[model samples]
Target: KKLDAKVKLWHHNSQGLFDYSTKDFQEYTLKWRGDAFLTKSNNRIQNQPSLPKTPIAKLKANDLALYPGHLFASLCQDLWLVARSFTNGYRLAPGDIVRLGAQAFKVKQICTDKPTNKGFSLTDLLVFQEPSGETSQVHSLPCRVCLSESYSSQNPLISPCNCKGSMKYIHLKCLQQSIKSRVHSTDYSLAFMFKNLSCELCSKQYSSKFYLNGELKDLLEIKNLPQPYVVLESLSCKEQGLYIASFCTKSILSLGRSHQSEVLIKDPSVSRNHAKLVYKGQGIYLKDNKSKYGTTILVKRPISLKENPHLEFQSENSTIQFKASGLVNLLPSCLRQPVAKGPKSPSLPLFPVNKGICLSTDDLDFLVREAQGELLNTSLSFCQDSIQNFEA
Candidate 1:
């Protein structure tokens, strides 16, 4: 009869229970049985699956009624309380201020552990206590680099990286000088400055820029020589840091894994002379040199089918091809509006009805004319800011 009742229960909840695997289903059944036993006896049974250490732990047998309405109604109060607790709870996040009596702390980092199948997770917080009334006036610690206690508002001491102990604190100027000594070159005209700007001990990369006395400052100062410069940040785990290559009008900057190349990538996939960046007519263009893993760019906007019927682009490991049929126009009439006469607004490539077209990585030369400025503007801005600081 008990087996028959269990079978009936399984059949009744089959729609909702079917998603669970055999193991999960068995565990859930065990949990339900354990919960029922605990509710009746108020004691844990051997080898019985435990209930969640939540308010629902004391769930009565009536709460698991066969009918949905009865079950929901019986469990409503506990569930509502749980929901309310979660909604009203405050979670500690990075940059949050936590108070402990008279002392205050600033949360620096929050590390969370992956949740278990039993719905158990652990979180750890790294925080530093803020200086209080009398402690704020003290400045006895010396800079790690210069070993001087002379700290001013302009050249204040800071602990930016994850390095602890005596190596933790250093004057901003001393730190900058130390970094400058390790720089590949001082000239910013047409050179690459590639150095791992990370703490050697902690293996933590220093912030590219930081704030000092409410003024923003660049960690690595680079003099601005001219415009039309390209900064390539290495994504390889072995090689890191910015590779700045400035270009003159009609000048070419070569990139490859070989040291002979102007911008060395140091990756196996890159050919000896993988690609070239040509600067001409107020813009920079990339030309691939028949590389093993051909050069590719991110497609920010849709390509026009009217201009190129056959389109090819790389997505991860696969090369995708899109060939448009001349039979019908997929675009609406509103999108097919004529270009305006005034100053050219940044618009998507017009996809007018035309014969079938084909596009390859070689045919994306139009991107250099249109999207290069927008793409490089952010890096250029950072470089420009560093230049200003260098000049000052």
Candidate 2:
């Protein structure tokens, strides 16, 4: 083909080494070999000739627009430009967080005025910067109780209650300390001690964060139906021995001096039918039979713990065999180890030397106090001297 006019082939340096200050065209011969571009130049185009030999397309710097932190759709306002960029390999989708300079913005939504080729639309993207600064994000939220950053050193904040926003974030340690303070307070309610901790806002019990560990979870979950059992200690009966009685389901146990009673109390002080230990479901109830000396549930408080934190046993008649139902919630981590239920023989001992349900110091304290009064502040720390003094 013969040339019609003077042709000026301009190929920009792909490596960006040689700087071109002006559009002043230099003399160069352009040739085509089966759609491959052949540009003959020296000291101008340093790399390979990537430009197409065909004159049907041309590359112009003005054809490209670079906009940061701004929507490309709004800047161009033309569906063709947006579609052109999409064909040129630029991904713009909803919920994708794009970065511009030091700020981050998330794409909220995408809408288009009209459909384009192949069911694709030139989208009008909507993006909003995510919450930043020293208060809005999680890094800025501080523990209200400790007055320090909650996640500075990997200390997680728990929002178990109804508190919202910044007030909701609180360190687990701080929350535990606050609960301990309330437990030790003079006006602390004993009823609330067994129940869940109430939130300061709604005054309703917290759904989560009820227990730091699985103590509460284990107490609430009753695995197998427990066989009712009772241990009697410190009774002024004739023998003054630790007695264990495993009764049948829904059966009534009679505690009296008469031999007809299931549990024989050979003492003159005890009436013919002193008290009845009624077993129903998973609970054991004590009903006084209107005797002269009323029935009282005796519980021995755990004052001093042994060298091992898990092993605790105090000698003498101070120990009380609390019924399984009332004492399950007062377990001091001993019940954490699953215990297998033995046979349903009434002759079986409740807590024998070899196979016995060992009670912790905290379990004993709570059991004793709960039996003595209706309302008593409960503490899991039975080893502490502040709780009570033992006979030594």
On lDDT, the candidate that comes out on top is 1
Error of 2 at 306 (Å): 37
lDDT per residue (tens digit) for residues 265-370 in model 2:
5555567876665554333444556554333211111111111112211111111110111122344556432221211111111111110112111243443343
Candidate 2 — worst ten consecutive residues by lDDT sum? 317-326
What lDDT does the true structure give each of the candidates?
A: 0.36, 0.30
The per-prediction CA RMSD against the true structure, in angstroms, equals 24.6, 41.4
- Per-residue alpha-carbon lDDT of candidate 1 for residues 1-392, written as tens digits (9 for 90 to 100): 01001111112232111111122221111222211211112221111223222211121222221111112223311100000111212222223222111112232322222222221110111112222122111167777888888888777777766677777788878877876664353232223333445666676666665665555555656444344354443333454444455553326767676777776555555678866656544334455565554544322222332343333322222222222222333557576323212122122232111111111111224433323333353344433432344335
Q: Give the TM-score of candidate 1.
A: 0.39
Q: Model 1, stretches more than 4 Å misplaced?
A: 1-164, 171-174, 181-219, 233-240, 316-392
RMSD of 2: 41.4
Models 1 onward score TM values of 0.39, 0.21
**Number of backbone collisions per candidate, in order?**
4, 0
